[model samples]
Target chain A: MVISPSKAAARIRAAAVDAFASAGYGGTTTRDIAARLDMSPAAMYPHYRSKEELLFAISFEGHTEALKVVEGADRPGEEPSVRLQELVSTFASWQAGHHSLARVVQYELTALTPEHYRTVVALRRSTTRVVREVVDAGVQSGDFTIPDAEGVTLALMSLCVDVCRWFPAGNYTNPEDIGKLYGDLALRMVGAA
Target chain B: MVISPSKAAARIRAAAVDAFASAGYGGTTTRDIAARLDMSPAAMYPHYRSKEELLFAISFEGHTEALKVVEGADRPGEEPSVRLQELVSTFASWQAGHHSLARVVQYELTALTPEHYRTVVALRRSTTRVVREVVDAGVQSGDFTIPDAEGVTLALMSLCVDVCRWFPAGNYTNPEDIGKLYGDLALRMVGAA
Candidate 1:
């Protein structure tokens, strides 16, 4: 069967993610992605105007996917600490499983054009907002004691994002172990009551 | 008089550091460093055999320099919490001040050949060992209550390494502030007394 337009776009984005993640963004070319797909570089132009655009597209997709994971893992009526633990642990495992996308999304922001960089940062801001809301809920419910929500958010993100650097394929540090450890640390960081 | 051999090497290394940090290790060329040094690439080959060798030399120098920072920051006789605080704060500042070297050292590891990777990893092992020693001391003295000293050490390193990704010139988060935030959170993570 012929590939659908959306499926084609996904393929292009996937190829770009690998190129940009394996080689730093500055080190890759659009032709590199096309070659990976066995198509002419111009063939990709219909889907993505440039490699930079494709990079941001994949990065945004990764953030959206992560948001869904967080939403899916939410426990409707659990205590705040329990919910926070589940969310952070799930986030770590997701990061480990999807490390290539995470690596490009987290590490290649600097190589984006100023406008594109701002766009990804906005996506980052929205993710920050989600964590903020979760943290705020915990604080309001008398389940936490963090005075600095931004700091706590950064700590949580740092824990999740850094997994890509060390947790590549066939590594000894298993995702389940990392997930549990990060969950405990994030919960303690906020002094969950 | 000709520049002393040591001075010549320092100039060459500084030139290479700037180039590699900007263009990345794989993308950088010896010609680029030589041009930056106002000399021909051939003239600089006496101190290094190849571009990869020069990169290895720079990588080795950076590895040793980082250990010094880790060692010097861990003061004896300080409270466990206080010492850990100082170590992170100083490390954050060290990252900011040496951003070029830090960028090159952290991000370019993938470019190393397997043999080179082993050497660099051994250097990393030493750095991890120092952090482990401090945590062990804290545990022995009843200052910290970590369940696994190794995992906690990995988490701490992850938090600090992510600093180079977000810290910008002049307006980056102050090392002391980061030190304060991470230290407080870290102590809480391990359920410190």
Candidate 2:
């Protein structure tokens, strides 16, 4: 019956994500999240004081996790084509594997408090920056041919970020397959030579 | 005050889109949408019996419009490369131009009734079919090369649909520019020769 403080907080967050994912941040109440965990609102109060705070927690964690994935995927000494393929495939599959949590993380930004929004936006920018750097390196090394790095980087990020929206649909049900497919497509998108 | 019934309904749908875009479908109430137009919920009931109905109306209209855009852009007689460029440019830019309404339409599908969801999804499939046909045409005509038409079509749709999420951000502000960028990227993705 007794759980550690961190474990309890993590449980509350997992429950809250499901609630918010199904009903949305605005539609979901702290009470609803509490009921999902079968905990009293008062018991849940110590971890997340308000709905917005729980959202911030989820947003912060998700963005941080995404940044780490992108960063870990990058191999600086590798050819730009290889780097981009790795980045896109890894990020896309991550988006798919954690789609429900990813959906809430991707879609509910406007619900975060301004300060929390900024923190999360910074994390997002960092993630984008990693892709941008690889894109720039590709252009510099002539491994990729593109009109502009900024625009190409934007499209690359958009493609990966959008996996959460329609993953496990049609024939693209498996995350690993998605990663492989996107890896090849990413190379093509950059005009890999 | 004397708006025609259709006009009144149109206005209501527009208001609901803004409300849903900001607060999400689960977060928004029909009363809130009515309040935005300074109309009582009683007056709004004739056009849309419930919030879900309003969402369905928006989804139906948005999907129908998107399908029309894709079909209109396809040039069956043209080279697949040219056809795809036109299709991607038009669809991406359209998604950008109508980003707010598009966001509501793209992200709020889970809020619709089962029948309504099916109806809207069919329209979506029609739109995707247009692009798939173009990709297949390109592959058959040797205008483009790809691993699979189905996967390419899915990526193409995802790239365009995601435009609403981050349009008008980081110098990619103009819808026309997005159109141009995506059109070029579509060619790259298909390995146009």
Candidate 3:
């Protein structure tokens, strides 16, 4: 059973995400991740050198993917309310769909090396900036009434980011359902006209 | 110097919270917590027999305190919008002020024993019910226009609960500031008239 280099690396990452999500970055060892994949630590060594390195990889990939999602969902030419609803619902649904991965990526970030941490934080800031720009545009166009752009942006990002934490609770068991609910709520939060 | 048994337990729990926050529950040990207090693990054993026991104590106490704070802040006799503002601001600020403890209590629930998890979750649901009732009341009085009371209530709680994850970011360093911002946003979420 031979796998391509990229395929092997992706498999290792998925296994590591599960391990990290269940036991946390500090509690999970590279060996545990290897065990999950049924690979020996030596065999896994070629892919990830250490636990922190694996965590960095996961964090980097997760944040980069998240930024892409938000950026992809943004239609700058659209009305601010429409832009926000799209941005939020897309981000929220992605967070829910990949919740286990998202949980590890979002919660275990502190375990990354400082350089890696800075890299991930920059990606996060970019994601936040995407939302902020939409909110600012909304406020400027008077399409949305908000008290303060910065605070509203923070709350919006917070609301979407937190979907990973509490999604699948009660009736919110589907990613699309969450997306719809959040989209409507985003409009309400911005006082959409 | 001798410490009262209760005080000793309190000190141990604080040390454990710091340990769990930095190292996570699976990564932290009773010995590490005892080391933080300059006490031997044997001495700490009387108060908390295991790391899981200490976590249960923290979860139980944190949830109990949080329930009290939410229930205390609820002014049922007031308008629904006013009641929600007070509830959200108070809850968000508490999450911020006790962010460290809140982080552990909120994020580490999966590591708790199933029995303990059930106990903590009931407390959480009770807290949610308090907010849900307010949203429901607001809708009944036509004071708030919301697509769904349950979703709105969930978002309100998620917004407040998430303060522990991203408090003190940028200009939002003060708990009161977070409270004020969240309180206003809660009204927007409910579409208060």
Candidate 4:
């Protein structure tokens, strides 16, 4: 009947994430999350004050994972064309693999509390800026010439977002398949070819 | 207030579409819908059996609209490439203008009841089939050399879905910008260029 605060918090977060992703933020209830964790609501209160806090936790985790993935894969001083390919490949692979979490980050925006929503939007913008920078660098070096860098960024990111919506990992099985295709498509779109 | 049942039903569908689009299907309620239509729950129930029926009506309406747009723009024997160009342009423009209803149709599949959900999925498959037909025709005619027609169809549909998500009509005011680019891009990817 006794669980450590840290361990219980982890269960609550995991349960909350499953609940949020499966049922969505609006449909999920704190009691529902607590039931999934097999813990009392009173116990969960010590870790997350409310369901909103649990949602914020899940969302922040998704964003942090995304940031780490992008920053880890992209290296400085790489060739514009190659680095651009690497960036998108990394992105599509990450998106296809971590689609549920990515869905939590991208599609669940309107469900967040206003303050938490603003935070997630800022994180999204930061990640998008990374894509924009790569596209601009490619354009500057004559490796790419997208008519609209910002619009291109939106398209590329939107492609990734669309992946989260549809790409069934089990059916596809290999993230590399979709990733490489999209990478080539993106490169050509930006005039990299 | 003795309104015809069909008129009352129409009002319910309209209110449901707006509510489902904005608050999303799960977040919307019969009371919210009735309030939007300036009707009491008692009065609204005569027109619709339950919330699920109203939701289904709205989703079906959007689905019908989408099929009309895609099929309406179809004209055979005028070059597969041109048919595809027309299809993508019309589809994307329809989505941009009918953003809310399109969101209901495109994003909220899980919200539909099981039978209705299957119906929507069938419509979606038919839409994709039409797209594949174009891609396949282009390949046979040497207008496109896409090794994988299915993948090309996915990319084309993804481009349109992405438009519904991020197409900002105000700033990205260029009509069918993403659609046109993707149409050309799809052709280029298939070696049509």
Model 4 lDDT tens row, B1-193: 8878788788788888887766767667799999997889898887787877876777787787787778888888789878888887777777777776777677777767899999888888887777778888888888876646776678778777767776573357665665665555555556664
Q: How do the residues A1-193 of candidate 3 rate in per-residue lDDT, one tens digit apiece?
A: 8899899999999998888888888788888989998899999999889889888888889999999999999998888888999999999999999999899988888878889999999999999999999988888898988888888889988988999998789988999988999999988888899
What would the TM-score be for candidate 1 when compared with the true structure?
A: 0.87
TM-scores of the models, in the order given: 0.87, 0.99, 0.99, 0.91
Across all models, the iRMS values in order are 2.4, 0.7, 0.9, 2.0
Q: Each prediction's DockQ? A: 0.50, 0.87, 0.84, 0.48
**Pick by TM-score: 1 or 3, better one:** 3
Which parts of model 4 are misplaced by more than 4 Å?
Answer: A1-7, A169-171, B1-3, B173-178
**Candidate 3, DockQ score (0 to 1):** 0.84
Question: What does the lDDT read for residue B56 in candidate 3?
Answer: 94
Instruction: Judge candidate 4 at residue B48 and give its lDDT.
Output: 80
Candidate 3, residues B106-190: lDDT per residue as tens digits?
A: 9999998889999999999999999999999999999999988888889999999999998889989999999998999999889
Q: Model 1, range B78-189, lDDT digits (tens) per residue?
A: 8787777667666666765676777778877876778998998899888877777878888988999876787888887777777666664223366666666766776777
Off by over 4 Å in 3: none
The parts of candidate 2 lying over 4 Å away from their true place are: none
Q: Supply the TM-score for candidate 4.
A: 0.91
- On TM-score, who's better, 1 or 4? 4
Put the candidates in DockQ order, highest first.
2, 3, 1, 4
lDDT (tens digit, per residue) of candidate 1 on A11-109? 988888877777767678888889999999777889899877887788778878887887787785888888888888888888888887888888766
In model 4, state the lDDT of residue B3: 79
Relative to the true structure, candidate 2 has a C-alpha RMSD (angstroms) of 0.8
Pick the winner on TM-score between candidates 3 and 4: 3
In candidate 1 chain A, where is summed lDDT lowest over 10 consecutive residues? A165-174
Extract clashing residue pairs from model 2.
none
